[model samples]
Target: MTPVSNGRPVTPASPGSLRRMAVTLPLVLALSACGGHVKGVMQPLDLAAEPRGNAVVDMLVATSRQPSDNPATLFSGERSALPSITDVAVSIPSGKVRAAGTVQWPKKLPPNPETDFAVVRVQPLATAQQGRDWVHRHASGGHAMVFIHGFNNTYEDSVFRFAQIVHDSGADVTPILFTWPSRAKVFDYNYDKESTNYSRTALEMTLKALVEDKNIKDITILAHSMGTWLAMESIRQMAIRDGSLPKKIENVILASPDIDVDVFSRQWSELGDRKPNFTIFVSQDDRALALSRYISGDVQRLGQINPAEEPYRTKLENAGITVVDLTKVKSTDRLNHGKFAESPQIVQLIGQRLVTGQTLTDSDIGVGDGITAIVAGTVNTVGKVAATTVATPVDLLSGNIRPLPKKKPADSGATFQSESAPLN
Candidate 1:
């Protein structure tokens, strides 16, 4: 009998693979407990009485999911004929009351702004012009940060997480979220993977629009897990279509990427020589990527690579990609898959350094030399005790770090087929 996963024929698993799955499946399920219970969290609340000290994150959300009929559930985890845009404001409890790098999910309906992350307002952008206007108003020094969320995420999940990141990182860029359809079920991995493929063109169009916007000077992309694949494919398509990516799109950060290692190599190679500076956050102990590796014919996943090991070390160094190895960064995240966003130090690194087009260095990381020693190795490192930051193309190992040259913008005549519209 042929093996089937999610109604699709898959290669038969080896005995060892099946044994590993038996051991890892339970942990994956336990770690994925956050999904399914929280629905309609995006429903705006009357936080008029909320205290002034609370932090509010105003984000522009673009999604390819069909709009939900319920106002609280603005978008569903299903494919849409076109992309939709909305402006959402999320309120996080003040620093005095809440810790950074944490999302305080409401224990009940009508989340209390005093403790939980709650939606304060929701507005539909009636046109692309409105989105552009929002960018102009919120963007600081023409800088924008775009976030693409990973697998098993609901619309509300993406919104709140990005809100936490923006609030914690204190990044001075306009926040935009590109959320694709994710069923938010542990067993729906295949469905979510296919959804990413389905939404690739929409993401490509969204990126092109940002590059063309006169008000946007620089853009930084942060993508996690399965979203990394989507982000890479979109950029590859853009490169193939336009000769080169716009220099304004400066930094691309991949965290816990759920991508096949071989496939990632090909994708990276296809981005052409003038690609944006790439930084990847990797952990060898990520259980999620381990499961993904098993499902993907037992091939190594990019996120679980040992950057210090052979081939990867040479390949990453040769490509001029900065790698942040987070294997020793202890986190409350049992799955060890989300250390990038869940760790306060790491998230701040994203906002304060990468978002502003600044390279990470020993002095930049407050952690002591122990962590720095690992990160300072051939592959840059950040863990519990020390942090190492590497400037691209500059060899930190050789102690020859220097500022990167200014990049000239690439000209492109590529046009996108419009697939975005305002929500009703």
Candidate 2:
């Protein structure tokens, strides 16, 4: 029998792999308990420099981390507060752009090794209202996509990754990042969890502020790993306080969520039928989530759950949840946990489907066979086997090869206004 994860065959763990994990697990747990160890101080790049790529991703950041004198040390969390918003100019690299991460500012266009994709400029907003207005102006068609990054991420890591997703996926809306006070260390899991919890109220405030903007049309939240917990909690808190779900939030995508099955179920219950269109990207091959499971006393992590397994598969789908298992999707990363963002095909799917507010389906690059077709097409395209071909599987996989039904526009007149003061 094939080794299975969520009813799908994954690269089976070998005796050697299991042995290695046994040796590493203890070390990781022990180190994680040690918590934050300060890393080298990061410095800001010159903002006056010209961008290498024509695309300038204006990343609006809202963070709960206490501000420090040093911008680089700004993210080391000591306490929580209302989020501060910062407008950052992330310069995308020209030519064949590889996966994006934060780099230094380039002196000229087509950044060389010295300067690559980095946060070149930042303008701080004096008030949350100012930040909301800025986002409103940038929001094409009143849509904003907020990204909540997982644990072990620095401020730079979170911002750069958001820029990469916005750029690669061709999302036309303004990109907002909710950066919690993550110690950004491999050993800081416990501290990170506490910090994430601490930031829930602040994140709720940030989303509330966005929703209050009369011009804001729709909001799409994409959270990864542990960040999913924060997102869900924030959303649930808002629903509890307001007695209804936030209407502006249209799409909620949780990828490789580092959340427990039971906890997620309760959070799901809180939505009370007013939940947004929800999508989950899970993978049995996610070693990070597998480790998370072991660390949580053998409790199954939502991201690694096999939907084909008993209880969960029916429970999730029955509640109108769409779960996509990406165990077979090839990834460039060793962990294979971030395949949702790392894979080009998946990125394209985000742009063509999710960004446009369309639901992903078999007819719309459906999972299983549809995903397989995308992987094959991507391989062929990357290999330059069909460089000149106008008709390719990529388009077919996105359901763009045939005519698609038009979607009705969201009711603009609807609002979530409340007399009660917004949560802080």
Candidate 3:
């Protein structure tokens, strides 16, 4: 099985991969020629565009990446010896509605079509401390959310995505992006992995600085794909060195993590029982993780695991971890891997629950439909498996752990496989 790269798969070179690319490239070109397009509306912002708009999302960024002077390029620079901070305002075209609720690049700011967004202005701070001060001053939620992007992303890609997330989720907290040096090329998975490892210490320092900040009340971390590994390792190091998890760290959310399950378990162990509330968004239908498993010659990846299946599932629940299974959730992306951040429903959930420091359970108004919420409790009996469960929100939150209905046989269940179909 060859792993095709849509710029996110972290797989090594292989003969099959070459063949897959050979087939994929022409198909992609043909689709483009016929007016097919991928990615959301949030286009890379034009550095020269007017800096103001009716709808604007101001983002604060902290990075260990080197800086780029090209107006057309934001952080196209290489890894820096030290971290840097910058602030930018993303302007949304009034009335514009993108297909995926994703931001799109408009030819101009305040685009006429009204359904678009653009990154209009970027200002580099004179010093990292100055940037932190700006974040402190502008933070409306009294807390901060640090977003770490995963494999095959450019600085612009991360910025736009973060902006879209903040806008769509309606989160009021200060947004801090911790971007590593990603080659942003489909074939540079190994390089990207190395970059993550290189950036871990810097990430730890950033977290430390946030915790030590007198104004910042709590810090919530949101990491996707490979970024989850980086985030976890940084926290683990902090715990090891400081002898406990940082008190100010409140929540840890991992979305579609691309880590080995065993490694994830080990990392969880390093945190002990004093860790922050943990939430993981997963789907058995994540095509990217499927390819990852194939490339690594491993059977299980943390993000792709069906938590209803085994000892690991019980382990997670016992720890009071919250798992939101999106296997049956509808998403605009065909890959179904990025739904944690891309799906509108999930985004709403994040805005309404996670970002505001609210608890999530199946009983929440929009939560229980096709999604499964798993938590640990006192009930020990295994319940019959069903596609959806309707437990009281109180039972879920009060630690009344019970087994979810066991899934049907493999032949009747959704198979874990790569999505080969094209996006609608």
Candidate 4:
């Protein structure tokens, strides 16, 4: 039986990373849980009881060792910093699966890398070189999509999810994932924030390293939820460091990013629009961001934008950024926000369009075959062009094609339609 922590339920999870609670239930369900190996803080939970739920116990009893819970060790000398995590599992999901990665933190961190910020485990999707290598082996001549996950996810889930896209779309290129510190624990708000804070420099360093390396060509960073802040801040810091984004940095795709739009605007002004082709995947049905909204005092949520309330999209679009508003789509249990990445069809859509350097219009990802179709048409308000009409190009990823309708032939705001579009 599981014990209760301060009246909240607590249960020992199956041996797995605490990230992606929805995907991996019972793992994060320990009593009085305040556990996470985030970058900044080094806190651990004191679980009183063992397995509280039947499913959790069953999973634990049934599942094999997925290199479970063997996180980056902490430093004995440095209480403030994290240890190195070098655990690199390079196996793709042998089947349809979802996963993520982390900058491996050492179990016992030292003063230097620890204080300077230590990463216990990082994804094999390491430097752009690694990304390029993967691309060389995979498809070629396509834009690279680097997916950075947000708060409270395990390294495995994030990796697997992105892999699903890469595997599905068969986009020929390396898919790099920047793994930060995610404690995978609930209610450890401050710790998670600290993780984000500490990871900023590391992310920039990663980008800078890639900029110097020539193997990786066109690249893009796909950030989700709070991961958006990290991506945004990384770009901002890069400018502050080198006075501009590195030449290699091609585009950025912010999918339901957890960020203040106004703050983002300020950062955008600093970075300028020309550096990285920026595309924002915003949705109105984002329940997760809604929770963030309530916690943040009814601010303009980045993810939850309805078609009627497309002000942020209008603003960003006018500013020459591509904004694909998924408000017309439906919201799932977590929120419509995460569905952009969680759902299979959506992942397929991302793999097909964005990864292929396809431009999008309202029609492509607007309806039918899942949310990703909205990406088929080119929608960015390029070069201070005040929201003019750009016909949906017949070939979003190529030279020239027939002109298609800018708007949808038949708008299906909420209607779900099955499609057999190639997993491009």
Best candidate, TM-score-wise? Answer: 1
Task: Kindly list the per-residue Cα lDDT of model 4 for residues 212-313, writing each as its tens digit.
Answer: 545567676778888888888888777755655765676778888777655564566456334466677777666566556545645665555542333433
What TM-score do all the candidates reach, one by one?
Answer: 0.83, 0.75, 0.75, 0.59
lDDT of 3 by residue, 84-161 (tens): 777877766544355435656555433433445555567778776786788778778677889999876778778878
Q: Which candidate is the best by lDDT?
A: 1
By TM-score, the better pick of 2 and 4 is 2
Give per-residue CA lDDT, model 2, range 1-424, as digits (tens). Answer: 7778898888978897798689568656643543232332234466556654546788789999877657654555555565677887766676454543223334454334333665566778998678867876787877788899998777767776787788878777778899998877776688898888999999888888878887778888999998999999999888767765787888888999999876786676455335677788888878777777766777778888776664655345434466777888877556667888876667777766775567665565555543521111121222232222222111211112222222321432212221121111
RMSD of each predicted structure: 9.9, 14.0, 12.0, 16.2
Q: Name the runs in model 1 displaced over 4 angstroms.
A: 1-18, 365-424
Model 3 whole-model lDDT (C-alpha atoms): 0.68
Model 4 lDDT at residue 211: 60
| lDDT, model 1 | 0.78
